[model samples]
Target: MKPNEKQVNIELTCTEIGGLWGIFIQESMNIRFLTYFMHHLQDEEIKPLTKVALEISEGRLDKIKQIFIKENFPVPRGFAEDDVNLSAPPLFHDIFSLSYIYMMNRLAMINFSYTASNNVRLDVLDFFTECIHTSTEMFGKVVKMMLSKGIYDRPPKMEYPKEIEFVQKGSFLTGIVGKKRPLNAIELSEIFFNIERNYFSVLVMLGFAQVIKDKKLKNHVIRGKTLSEQQIKFFNNLMMEEDLLGTVPVGMEVTDSTSSPFSDKLIFSMINVLNSVDISLISHAMSVSMRTDLTAQYSKIIAEVMLYSKDTFDIVVEKKWLEQPPLVTNRKKLLNSD
Candidate 1:
């Protein structure tokens, strides 16, 4: 970084790796659930797909560990064998499992793109590049399987415009009062996709509420269900105002079984995954909305969720379930003591 300093054979420092939080948290989760799926899954069609993702997650985690070691950074104590109980009954239906993979990997692909783009270190770049490729392959497989099963929820259909047209008036941005313009195709796409995203959270929290045994976490998960319900309602009302169908959650797909299939730590960590992504999704919606009112709505929701996410993080901390990300040394403390 200085004129007199000469550096060679560069290795990645923690700061140089972009999106490590996402990679660490997400792959840790994948390790838990992917292992669970491999244990309880009976579907011949989806088993291989699950295994492929598991291998990638395990391999990536190992590489991340080695990098952290070489840098003398504390390797995060991510979820492990203790986080899940494979012998427990299958908590989710096989179909839901497949859909989860599809949706999660889709999210991963989005994250991997940003991670790769922002990273300067060559190995970090290469790792996320491969992440994108692996996620794409898994997403394609699950989507094909879901489509063949005839359960893939397609977005609302609209007739093509007779001709290309430009925005004719400033009213397009107004939604606070008076008749608002019909949701444009881009607006429609984002809203629908957002609802679908919340739909996953709603059902997952529901399932978590049922199976989680710890009293505090049970209450927390139940409240999370309430939060997700409110979010889904917000998105659904927008869709319904235009006569578009709202997303049907996989809540009913969860069986009425009251067994703990995963540890409280894993359940809490999964909620962390949901919390992190919800913030990002809201930010993206805010960026893409043309209507002032829609942006305001997303902002309000983001504020509420930010507080909720802090509470969620507090729970993880209280239980010491959180793993610290790599940080710089406290040299001043050492110098003061000496």
Candidate 2:
């Protein structure tokens, strides 16, 4: 290894730029989420987790913003002062807040893992690596805190197997006919995880629906809630048909107050961000699902969700609320310049 053979630090690749744009927006929104949680969190054990979350998001934002500037890219107009009203009363219970952070941190860790793997630039790689570490710590603390508080709903338990065996049955690939094979761990985990998100999604959309004043926005929220309910039914019934404990929604445990604690923009942005993740999650579930019926179900739902998410973007754009991310100049337009 010669001194001159050292790897050169290159400019940010398109993947890095695009991926960072996505992560930066998500991090910014999380900052807003943490701020609200910090203001409303009552439990001493829970407040520390919010603080950890806040610190992680704030620090990561600084690094991401610096990279955007370094590469002459436009930093996204993510969540801002207008997004949250800290003076408002607590909209949800402390337990719900803790659970929210727990779920969000789990998602963030997965996000950073993917971003880190795809990154080529040293600084970008370094930034997302740090994010993965911080998110790991944050979720770890959140899980411990939730368990100690007796709010952690552990994933469904399964029987322990004594030995490993190779599959010889052709029934493994078929679910359209008699005697469908039981769900493997991969299929069950994905289905269960999706059910969990749908449960929380219903809670959030229901809250937003009750509080938001704009009729159009209110209608949109209502639709999202309905979609969540349908999806939950679809997934939960799959398990119920198998004679298993169906997915239980975490008791829509929100306050009765109709006053919104967040701006419409914030609500819409959050829904958009999470709905995007649902598409990816559903795709993953589809890939792992060997059963014909389950795979088709995933595909059908993905199309529905993808359409809904597109509508969300359309609304954001119509209201001029969509933030422009970094992009190369329009070369064709440039060629036409006088």
Candidate 3:
């Protein structure tokens, strides 16, 4: 290979290696958590299922280790002595644990799918395919459990709104002045659907925050919850214009269980902060493509939410749980100029 080609091959190999290690680490940590749950589980049916999962994970772990060894690569030290707490009380109930498992399996499948597509090595491709199959099977089991429990948390059904108005094309100065072209039902539905999806992500994150114990994190979660609620209302009103329902799925129940494998406060707080930032970024992009009036209103709402987020960040910094993100020195001037 040419020098550049050799470098590229090395980089790809390193990337694939890191990805494989990540999978191993995640699976090992999950297996540890499941093993702990197995000991504390009261339900006979669930216990067996947990045991089976644990075995499958352990088998996969062994296979990965063998692959590393065969390739003369150092195996990853996943979840060493300091990484697990065997003595800690069960942090989640059977149902919750199963749901978590299901979510993780889905994540694993996605990761493996991506890796399999990218890696040209036959051995790596085969390994990722095995991982994909394992996660798929685990996901199937969890979905079956969810079905049995009758807790499929599907979003509410919605139909197209009856009354539709054409959005008139116009310049920024003359609102709806130039051409009055009616929007089709499909176009209207797509806009509302995108809004609803955004709202749903925010609400679920909020619900998770409500039960978080850390005071700083609690504030952040609550702020996120409110932000999501406002967005939901905004979308709902927009749908009302078209006479359509814009309801998003909300988790019906939340657990206040104090026991947590990780820092509940930190996890919830991080989740809220990350999700808010993501939403803000998307909203900013959306504003560019949207009508001026719609953009202005959305920006105003986002600004308010961002203020709340800033307050929460302050709390986190005060508690010393997180380092403050870098601030722009000319933020005031930038906003004023805008």
Candidate 4:
């Protein structure tokens, strides 16, 4: 293919990727609300925990929305009027909801890892990696809680560790000095920035979902609360590691009041911006392999969030609050002509 043709293909791929990412964001929002709505029946003891998880999911959702806007990409209508049941019976009990949260976090870790590794954009990779760390920590905490309640799942142990012996003819440098190095501050900062952006978005989504009347949706929001708090800490730590002040753009306010604080157009626009940011973060994380653990965690978080966001889209569609964007056909062909 010609250089121009190749460029068009690349652009098309990126656009598709961005759209796919948007789907994830929308689904995440849905999951957040579902968890929150389910937690309303719990006593005071479990209420706080549910609240924390809800916050985290909402915050991440907001970040994804901002990313799409920043990239000038169209954010898809994630949910439709047919997706939610405002009058349905409760879908999950309190303990079941908590277990679901734990499962979602674990899944998030896996997804973050995949994105961090595959994304070519350095900034995007970094962001996902940081998310991975945050999600992992959250998972750990949830697991602890499950253990305390004797509700945590336990798999059978393996027989033994797999081991291999290396040849002994290596030089001193080969044995110790030639190992892979740590990521530089610049690289770390890029990843950190990505994490900060994602966390901000998640918090925003959680705050917005708090007002949904459905018990399942409300429970999801509650679960996201703690995840958001943990993400903030992760971003702060990343900033400190890079010797820089931790700062991330807060997209928009999410409130529980019956009055809408912002127009539906504005909300979807912000979601687009957040999606762009997430892509950037994933790119950065991929540039440096030293942060593998972080990358893995973020991937998982993104995947789980995507599931929940889809649910939220359904809710928005049902309420007729979603704003439609101008549809664009295959623009790649036009790019090739020029």
lDDT of each: 0.81, 0.83, 0.59, 0.52
Residue runs of model 2 more than 4 Å from their true location after superposition: 1-9
Of the candidates numbered 3 and 4, which has the greater TM-score value? 3
lDDT (tens digit, per residue) of candidate 3 on 1-338: 55334222233365567666766766666676577678667877677778878887888788778767777766766554333444555545556556556655755776678778877665566778888898899888887887787754443345567787555545532323463232344435435544544454453454446445667666766666666677668767665665556554434433454444444433434454445644544464444543444555566766776676677666656765553222336787978994
Question: Tens-digit lDDT track for model 2 on 65-182?
Answer: 9878877777788889778988887787777877678788888888889878998766677778888888898788888887887666677677887899788988888988868888
Runs in model 1 deviating more than 4 A are 1-8, 18-22, 70-73, 331-338
Q: In what order do the candidates fall by lDDT, top score first? A: 2, 1, 3, 4
Per-residue lDDT tens digits for candidate 4, residues 174-211, read 31245423334445555554554445456555643543
**Which residue pairs does candidate 3 place in steric collision?**
none
Clashes of each: 0, 0, 0, 124
TM-score, candidate number 1: 0.91
What candidate 4 gets wrong by more than 4 Å, as runs, is 1-23, 26-39, 80-87, 158-338
Error of 4 at 106 (Å): 1.2
Better of 1 and 2 by TM-score: 2
True-structure RMSD, every candidate? 3.6, 2.3, 9.6, 16.8
Descending-TM-score candidate ranking: 2, 1, 3, 4
For model 4, what is the C-alpha lDDT against the true structure? 0.52
